[model samples]
Target: MRVLVTGGAGFIGSNFALRARERRPEWQLTVIDAMTYAANRASLEPVLTTGEVALVEGNIADAALVDGLVADHDVVVHFAAESHNDNSLDSPWPFVESNVVGTFTLLEAIRRHGKRLHHISTDEVYGDLELDDPARFTEQTPVNPSSPYSATKASADLLVRAWIRSFGIEATVSNCSNNYGPRQHVEKFIPRQITGILQGVRPKLYGSGLNVRDWIHVDDHNDAVIAILEQGRLGETYLIGADGERNNLEIVRMLLELMGKPADWFDHVDDRPGHDLRYAIDSTKLRRETDWQPRYGDLHAGLAQTIDWYRTNESWWREAKVAAERTYERLGR
Candidate 1:
C-alpha cells in the first residue's frame, strides 16, 4: 500500500509516520508538509535516511500539488492544520486557509481520484463540557467550536461529511482528544511547561489552572488511526481517547513532581479569551468497533517518558523554544 500523510513533519503526524514504518514495513510512504514554523524536518530524518519514507514540502491547500499527490497514493491521512488556540486568536486567517481550504483541496482530489482518506480532527470542535458535567463528548455531540482554530477544524470536518454524502467519497473522520509525546512544538502547554522547567524558568499556567483536557500519548493515537484506516466503515466518525482526563493545574503539579521541582514552582498567567472550561472524549465506538486499546494507560508513566525525550533531545527543540518563549512573553502568557 502507498500511503500519503499530510503534515507529516509536525508532532502527531511525524510520530504516525514513524509508527507506520515500524508496523507496516511493506507500505510505501510519502509525507507532504508545509514545513511551517510548527513543522520540523528532523522529525522524519530517520525514515528518510532508510528510504522507507519520502518527504515533500508543500502546503495542502495547493490544489495542483495535492491533486498530483492524491492521485499517486492509495490513501491520504490528513493531519495538516494551524492547531494552536492562542495563535488562532492572534491571527485567524492562517487557520482558515490551512484547515478549511486545505481539506477542501484534498476532498476534491480524493473525489476525482477515488482514493481512500482518513481525516484527522480534534475534540475541541465539539466545544467544551461544563466542569461539573459528567458527560463526555460522544460521536453524536454537535460541533460548537469555541476558537478560530477549532472553528476551522469543524468546518473541515463538515466539508468531509458533505463530500462523503454528496459526492460519494471514500473517507472516514476521527476526532481525537489532546495528544502528548515527543516531537511536539514547545509552544504547546505540556512541552512549554516541561522545557521551561529544564531551562530554569518557572512553568506558566493559564487563569486559575482549572481548565480540563483529555490527554493521550501520540503513539496510542496513531495506533487507533491505523485501526480505523484498516477496519472502519466509510462515512463514519469515531472519537479517539485514552480516558486520561486531567486539568491544567493537576498537569503542572505532575510535571513539577516528575522533574523534582516543588509543586508551587509554576506561575498563573492570564487566561485565554473565551477559553473552554473543559474537554473530555468518549471513545466507546472506536474501541468496540476496532478492538483497539491504548498502551499508555497511566498518565504519570507517559509523562515521565515524555520528559526524558525532551531532556535527551534538547537540540531538536532548542531553537524553536527560544522563539516560542518570546511569543509567550509578548502575550504575557
Candidate 2:
C-alpha cells in the first residue's frame, strides 16, 4: 500500500508517519509539506532513515503538485494547514487559503486521481460548547465554528463532504481534540509556557484561563489516524481523542509544577475575541470499531513527558521560534 501524507513534518503528522510505517512495513510513504514554521525538518529527520519515506516541499494548495502526488497513492491523509487561533486572529486570509482552499485542492486532486482520502479535522470546527456536557462530540454534531482557524477547518470539512457526494471521491474526516507532545511549535500553549518559564518571562493567560480543551498525545493521535486510514468507513467521519480534558489554568499549573515555576508568575491578559469556552470529542466509534487505544492515557505523565521533550530539545525549539517570527512579521497585524 502506498500512501501520501500532507503536512507530514508537523507535530502530529510526523508522529503519524513514523507510527504508520511501523504498522505497515510494506507500505511506501510520501510526505508533502510546505515546511511552515510549525513544521520542522528536524522532527521528520528520524522518519527519513528508511528509503520508503520521501519528503516533498510544496504547498498543498498547489493543484498541480497535489494532483501528481495523489494520482498514484492509494491513500491521502490531508493534514496540511495554517493552524493557530492567535495567528488566525491576526490574519485569517492565510488560514482560509491553507485550511479551506488547500483542502479543496486536495479533494479535487483525489477526485482527479480516484484515490481515497482521510481529511484530518479538529474539535474546534464544532465550535464552543454552548452547553457544557461530558459526552463526546458525535459525527452528527452541527458545525458552528467560532474562531477563524476553526471556521476554515469547518469549511474544509464541508468541502470533503461535497467531494464525496458530488464527485464520488472515497474519503472520511476525523475531528480530533487538542494535541500536545514533542515537536509542537513553541508558539502553542504548552511549549509557550515552558519557553516563557525558561526565559524568565511571565506566561500570559487569557481571561481566567478556564477555557477547556480535550488533550490527546501526539503518539496516541497517530495511532487513531492510522486506525482510521486502515479501517475507517467511507463517507463517514470519526472523532479521535484520549478523552483527556483540561482547562487553560489547570494546564498552566501543571506546566509550572513540572518546571518548578510559580502560578503567581502568570501575566493576566485580556481574553482574545471569541475564545471558545470548552472543546471535547466523543470517540466511542473509534474505540469500538477499530483496534485503537491511546498509550498516553495518563494526562499527568503525558504532560511531564512533553515537558521533558521540550527541556531536552531546547535548540530544536530555538530554531523553530526564529522561523515562526518570519510568518508573524508577514501577517503584520
Candidate 3:
C-alpha cells in the first residue's frame, strides 16, 4: 500500500508514519511536512533511512503539490493542520489557511485522484463537555467549537463532509482527544509539563487547573487509525480514544510525582480565553466496529512511561526546540 501523509512529521502523524512502517514494511510512504516550529524532522529521522519512507518538505495549502501527491498514492491521510491551540490563539489566520483551506486542497485531490481520504480531527470540535450532564461526544454530536483552533478544524470537517456528500468522495474523519507520548511537540500540555519538569521550568496551569481531557497515547491512536483504513466504512467518522478522562491538575500532579518535583513547581496562570472545561468522547462505536485496542496500560501507567521518555530523550527534544528557536527569531516572538 502507498500512503501520502501530510504533516506526518508532527505528533500523531509521526507516530502514524512509524507505526505504518512497522505494520507494513513493504508499504511506500510519502510524508509532506511544512517543517513548522511544531514539526521536528528528527522525530521522523529514523524512518528517513528506511528508503521506503520519502519526505517532501512543503505546505499542505499548496494545491498543486498536494494534488500530485494525492494522485500518486492509493490512500491520502490528511493529518496536517495548525494543531496548537495557543499558537492558533496567537494567529487564527494560519489556522484558517491550513486547517480550512489546506483541508479543501486535499479534498480537491480526492476529487482529481479518486483515492481514499482520512482526515484526522480533534474532540475539541464538540466544544466543552458539561460535567453535570451525561452527554459524551459521539460522532453524531453537534459541533459547538469554543476556540479558534476548534472552530477552524470544525470548518474543515464540514468541508470534507460536503465533498463526500456532493462529489461522491471517499473520506473518513477521526475525532480524538488529548494525545500524549513520545515525539509530541513541547508546546503541548503533556510534553510541555514533562519537558518543563526536566528543565526546571515551572509549568503553568490555567485557572484552577481542573480542566478535564480524555487522554489517549499516540501509539494507540495510530493503531486506531490503521484499523480505520483496514476495516472502517468510508464516508463515516470515528471517535478514537481510550475513554480515559483526566484533569489538568491531576496530570500535573502525576508529572510532579514522577519527576520527584513538588506542587510548588506548578505556577497557576490566568486561563486562556475560551478554554474548554472538559472533553469526553464516546468511542463505543469505534470499539465495536474495529479490532483496535489501546496498548498503553491505563492513564497512570501510560503517563509514567511518557514521563520517563522525556527524561531519557532530553537531547531529542532539546535539539527539536532549535527549530522553534528559529521560528521565534523569524516572528520576533
The CA lDDT of each predicted structure is: 0.96, 0.85, 0.86
1-333 per-residue lDDT for model 2 (tens digits): 888999999888888788787887788999999987778888777778656589999999999998999987999988888889988888899999999889988888888878999999999988877436755578889999998999999999999998899989999899999999888888787787777677676776778888998999988888888888778889989998888888889888888887788767686677878988888888899888899999998899998998888778888898666555466446441
TM-score of 3: 0.94
lDDT of 2 at 25: 79
Q: Extract clashing residue pairs from model 2.
A: 136-282, 137-282
- Model 2: lDDT equals 0.85
Q: Of the pair 2 and 3, which is ahead by TM-score? A: 3
Each model's TM-score? 0.99, 0.93, 0.94
- Work out candidate 2's RMSD over C-alphas: 2.3
lDDT per residue for candidate 3 within 64-142, as digits (tens), equals 9888888899998889999888778777899999999899888988898799999999999989876666678899899
Q: Is candidate 1 or candidate 3 better by lDDT?
A: 1
State the weakest 10-residue window (summed lDDT) of model 1. Answer: 324-333
Off by over 4 Å in 2: 130-135, 322-333
Candidate 3: list runs displaced more than 4 Å.
Answer: 319-333
Q: Which 10-residue window in model 3 sums to the lowest lDDT?
A: 324-333
Candidates in order: C-alpha RMSD to true structure: 0.6, 2.3, 2.5
